[model samples]
Target: MERNAPVSRFGTVEVEDLPDDLRERLAPVVERSGFTPNIFRALGRRPAELRAFLDYHDALMTSDEGLSRAERELVVVATSGANGCPYCVVAHGAILRLRTKEPHLADLVATNPHGCELEPRQRAIVDLALRLALHPAGFGEADLRAARDAGLTDDEIWDVGSITAFFAASNRLAHLFGLRPNDEFFTMGR
Candidate 1:
């Protein structure tokens, strides 16, 4: 399942070439993940944007909110799918499978929700994330009400929106830079 190596549309930035602060911050991630994601490298084309993006990303994805890690990954996969961002769908779908131990669930959510055997609450979360990703301008009170009715706490609902918004920005950036998913993402958790 290895894809072609990503050729940086924004050109490349070797980790050693990064500023000291970013290099330090990305060290643990590269050590844990075994590679620095192309997103980090692609965004590094603009150090300020990359730093800001990663800061917000860490805040949302590593929050104390009620949304479980798997649930947060779910929002990322679902919203990335809606955005047609292949990089995020593949990368976060791998994370979703690894976290949830449900290999089929990622494809189900990405390709078609009806195909996924999600619980009602899970379905509600995915629905909200997709809506936010696809139709943010149309989102309103009723959307929040539906999420609450689905038993999501206020914090979890906030997490869902925040994750969706973050990924919406991420999706565009990935596209803008022609960032590709790491080859390892394709085989993860399978």
Candidate 2:
């Protein structure tokens, strides 16, 4: 695996060395982001898994009916924080800021949603995401009831769980591989 840049724990396989399909897929991400996110490079070590993971991630993050883009990214940021994955926290926090157009919101949510000055609905949602991260097995019917009472639709509730679950896997992967957030992530949407 050849790394184009020194951004990942396991250096990203060089773009030229990637299989044709992988190269095609990665080109646009690099072009649009101006750099490859470390997750993309780290996961690229296993081309098949990278494709599968990206497909699922695109579906989960881009779905329009369930949660708004900002809401989805919030779930990721909050859960990533709970998991203590700074890479996800920083990267997703940048995305969350872009989506919400509020420069301070991501840092607020990532560090402490409960103490943050969020609307009731956002507070409920972030709280749920955090609990899901910290206590997946402890989720209960009351949790669902609370979210519903906070005005989240059934679809949105489902989205919250799905995003959190996906990032749980991603956060663990980053920790396992020692992936670091790209430097661009820190200043993005600032």
Candidate 3:
């Protein structure tokens, strides 16, 4: 590892030293971001798990599902914030700002979704996502009804819950591994 390379508390695996599959996966992310995110590098410690993780991430975040990219990122920011995941909050918040073209929206949603002045549909989505993240056991049919009443389709409702569930795992992973958000995330979209 380079002396200055960002290292997670669990340690990082060098990209070049990673398996061929992992190196291939990291290439595009590095090309797009101009640097390998610490999550990629750190999670690379387990190539197989990273592959599975990234595959699931791509399916959930990139696929043309009921949620738009911005909406998915909104779910991430909201849920991750409720989970107290600094890394996801900052990183996905940057993505949210970029997608929405609202610089302060990220911080507002992460810190206080109610204060974000979200549209009614968006508020329903955020509220449901947060409830799932903060208290999954408490999630109920009424929550789905509220989301549907706000114009979310059943597919969209599934997405809201799925994205929230995924990020709940991601948030805990960040906490467990002590993952840090890239510095670039702090200023991107602003």
C-alpha local distance difference test of each model: 0.88, 0.87, 0.86
Stretch of 10 with least lDDT, candidate 3: 1-10
Off by over 4 Å in 1: none
Per-residue CA lDDT of model 3 for 1-190, tens digit only, reads 2235345788888788899978987899888878778888888888888998899898899968698989999999999989889889988998899999999877988998766798887898899898888788988998888888889999998898888988889889888887878888889999
In the range 45-162, model 2's lDDT, one tens digit per residue, is 8999999998999999988887888989989988988888888999999989888999999898888867899988889889889878898899999999999999998888989999
**Root-mean-square deviation per candidate:** 1.7, 3.2, 2.7
Error of 2 at 121 (Å): 1.7
The parts of candidate 2 lying over 4 Å away from their true place are 1-6
Candidate 1 lDDT over 49-167, as tens digits, reads: 88999889989998765898899999999998888889999999999999999989999899895457899989989999988888889999999999999999899989999999899
Q: Which order, best to worst by lDDT?
A: 1, 2, 3
Evaluate residue 187 in candidate 3 and report its C-alpha lDDT on the 0 to 100 scale. 90
Query: How many clashes does each candidate structure show, in the order listed?
Result: 0, 2, 0
